[model samples]
Target chain A: MKVRHSRILRTAGDMLLPLLLLFSLFLLLRGHDLPGGGFIAGLVASAALALYIFSRDMRSARQVLGTDPRSLLGVGLIIAILSGVPGLLAGDAFLTSEWYTVPLPGGREFTLGTPIIFDIGVYLVVIGAVMTIVLSLAEAEERPWKR
Target chain B: MSLAVILPILIPLSAGALSLALWRSHLAQRLLGVFGTGALLLAALWLLQRVWLDGIQVMYMGNWPAPFGIVLVADLLGAIMVLLAAITAFAVALYSLATLGAEHERFGYYPLLHMLLAGVCGAFLTGDIFNLYVWFEVMLVASFALLILGGERAQMEGAIKYVTLNLISSALFLSAIGLLYGLTGTLNMADLALKLQDTGEAEGLVTTIGLMFMIAFGIKAAAFPLFFWLPASYHTPPVAVSALFAGLLTKVGVYALFRVFTLIFTQDTAFTHELLLWLAAFTMLSGVLGAAAQFEFRRILSFHIVSQIGYMLLGLALYTPLALVGGVFYLMHHIIVKANLFLISGLVYRLRGSFQLKELGGLYRERPGLALLFLIPALSLAGLPPLSGFFAKFILVRAGLEAERYGVVAVALLVSLLTLYSMVKIWNEVFWKAAPEQGAAAVAPTNNALLYAPAIVLAALTVAIGIGAEPVYRLAEQAAAQLLDPQAYIAAVLGEAS
Candidate 1:
């Protein structure tokens, strides 16, 4: 019974983080048109991940993240760069964003496009960068030398 | 040919990765240094040629167009900085070969050094403000690692201070970028420049954004009150690493300040310009006075670095063509000379095993060549005649006089004399005094060619720049002109959209 109870709490913790991360993404994506965007969202997601790492072991969390934070940083940078390319393709100049419409299964086509992608790129960058610093610092602190 | 623009950043980044992955082998690390520095040098020289012969070079990665794509720019200013970075990186790499031992090499030093170089190059070439922030973080992370590479007590203490201060600066930088993006609705520097031009000089959101950006850059450049973190942290690292950090890192901040202030925030001259002038004067006086009070060789040199930064800031604060050119020239001279001096200190430490001036004396009688090596750069740093440092100061002081800013000129002259006094103090203490018996015995006369080679090469370049002042001065003048103009930069990036 105790094992099941602890298991339930573990699953609750795990589930809570991704949900919060998604909510942060929502805030980041809607930021330009609304209140939040890439940076704050990224920070939120990173904070959630930090909680997960604290509750769980770092090694397992690393497995879930699937790469070193440094590589994630590079990938984020590349995506950010790629997001800016569409505006360049339209000859709008570097990092220029353009809006477009994509059809959904419903009767209406929704407004979708590059600025959001750029935000997502920024999201990845901030999350990756902040995590890299935090994780390194945590690891450094964990060493026996501190005692 | 646009590939020329990306190569400088890419080569070092790849080499850095390779070094980290192959950390078990010292041979691989050494090879990484050779190939990385070589490729960077070749690329910088090629880019310089292209900039000189064919005008500004802009590369949009993966065939993207401007204003929408991330752009790598190689105008005269960017290209010259790239070249300067390449020169210092190469020399520092050579110096590190002798200064760093196997244990230090095993601690991921080479990889971090290359990443730091990549960050510096990327910061120099990037045309987007957000991209510049990313690169700044890259440089900062690598610097943090390098600072604490040995994990000694002193290293940890310094690293904590360095990381905290830089993290605050980075946060400010990010917040500024967010504010600017919110206000202007674009992150591209070129796009913002065009947008700002149409927006005209105003006292509202633009000024607020401008102030934020200036504070961010000012902190990074270690200007005035923002400079306290530098002297506290700089003396903790190994000499070669500190030399490279001293030479390139803050200059990257100054470079960003120069780029953004010239292109986007030109309208707010009254606020930014006057603030920079006062800050420059304070930074100069405080830095030199701090140096005058230091008894250690490295600590004194570190303080002098702050003081010299004032001259560079003075150029920008004055904001005339001559003054800007002087600022640019001063940056070039300061990087080479400052790096060389730090490397010489490394040599001194190697010979005497102590950096404190009071601990030992009388090196001139023992090692005349090293003494001369130290003397030349020290003199140049003091703004003595017929050296690159003098010409840089002359241009700045002349511009101050021409503008009839008599007070600034007077301060500049006073700072120069103090700089001379500080340099002479180092000379008198380290080279001229009689060798203490224990100190002289500790100094074994061993010739390490790799270490001295970089210093000698840097000193020779100092003379070369001094002799070939006409062309170099003209290059700086062109760069300064382009900075003041902004239309060309905006048009180049924005193209026909405007």
Candidate 2:
């Protein structure tokens, strides 16, 4: 389970990690209107984290994340559930999406809606859940004596 | 009004999420577990009352038209099932507070339990077949985690069998859904019902898909030849989990079978129901026989779950109005009684430090209250008069006799005798016999109130169901009438325009 020290791989990982994270965010944002969505973005982000874990170690990966993946999962689910409440409050069915327009400084308008919020929640959950699984399995592998 | 349909699912889902967020705070998680389940019970009650008064209640998810988007529909049966699930969740939540160790609670027991409840409620309330499958997976994942929460050797073994078999069942279920969708071009169950009836040319292919569904749900319900997983795994979890599983899990499978057969697969009942009749007989015979051979408390009770499913299946297999009523009544009666018996078993374990019958005894002399509580569900399970099981069995037997299904009726009667034999075996060893000399060394826990309260309430409900059989019977009859004729459910879900 221990990873060997590889200078080239670590450098590659350092370069690729931020790029993958940025791309995942783009996928998540455009999910409502485009082909990409939260689920795929999550997988991509977790893959980036997995690369970091391999290059450095599980501890560094945990340190980079800075919080337990489980909390991310919890927050994600609550956000999704809350996203549905506005619809219910409006006397519509549960999960009914409502739209709003945001005007920026340049007078450009952006569409905001519950579906995108729901997709963000899905994005977080996918990342959190996949990372939780990958990290646990990797950690479990390190302690072969316990098994 | 629409909130009633979604609240049963949302309440548990929200509680689970909040519990996860508040995982470090045990007190908060515990309170959330209890109050959340309590809220679900109230919501389910409100839903049942609404359905009872207003006929089928439908909520189109996200305001989409039915047949195009998912819908949560609560007919009499769905509402009743949801209510029963909430009741079981509440009872188990209370019992879990006392029984679960701090280690397990910290490992997310409360959250997982609530998630399971949400899944069960969603399965019950959903009007779309694909949605039901999603709910089943949700329930399965939560249950898989709950089963192996402690990571004991035995639990791992049990969970492997449990998960492996269930995954296969899920695959079969998904494939059947895929095939059905391909044939009918619809996934909405009400719309599917309409389209399926119109597809006269594809009757044979439809029947094949129906059989696939039967086998899929049959495995879930632990019907005969597919129930080896139940006895192997159910007794391996902590008794609180066992009680929950015993109470609600298989019954959900039975509920799916009831819904599918009554609602969608009625075209070929001559073949499908006939198959169910034989499965019912064998499930009963084999289950009771398996219990008779077991000496462990929960294992015996576990086998009895499979056996009891037989009687419920008989109610469906008979396919008459009175027979369906009996099926519904048996469904309610079995859930209450089986769960009570499991809870009582947990109490006995606390007192004796073991679930092995040979190591247990003398409860009648030491704890008369526990003895009386035990006797209520035991005798009722044995179909003793003026108890819930008696009425459940009497109606099924009468329905069978009227239908002239003499062979299965004979088998049902025989299974009842054998069921009594197993209960007597537990009684003789665990209650009436002399306690082992070392048995007193295992000190009972101090929180006796929390331990006994749920069982006492459940036992009282068993007695109430027996005494108040008329109203419950009327509700079951109305549910049965609806199942026999799905036009109202179809209209409710797809609107009158359909």
Q: Quick one: best DockQ, which candidate?
A: 2
Q: How many backbone clashes does candidate 1 have?
A: 13
Residue-wise C-alpha lDDT for candidate 1, range A65-88, written one tens digit per residue? 777776566566656666766765
**What lDDT tens digits, residue by residue, belong to model 1 across residues B106-207?**
667898999899999999999889999999998998899899766778888878877888898889889989988887788889888888875655546787
* Poorest stretch of ten by lDDT in candidate 1 chain B: B437-446
For residue B102, give model 2's deviation from the true position in Å. Answer: 1.3
Clashes of each: 13, 0
Tens digits of per-residue lDDT for model 2 on B95-131?
Answer: 9988888988967899899999999999999999999
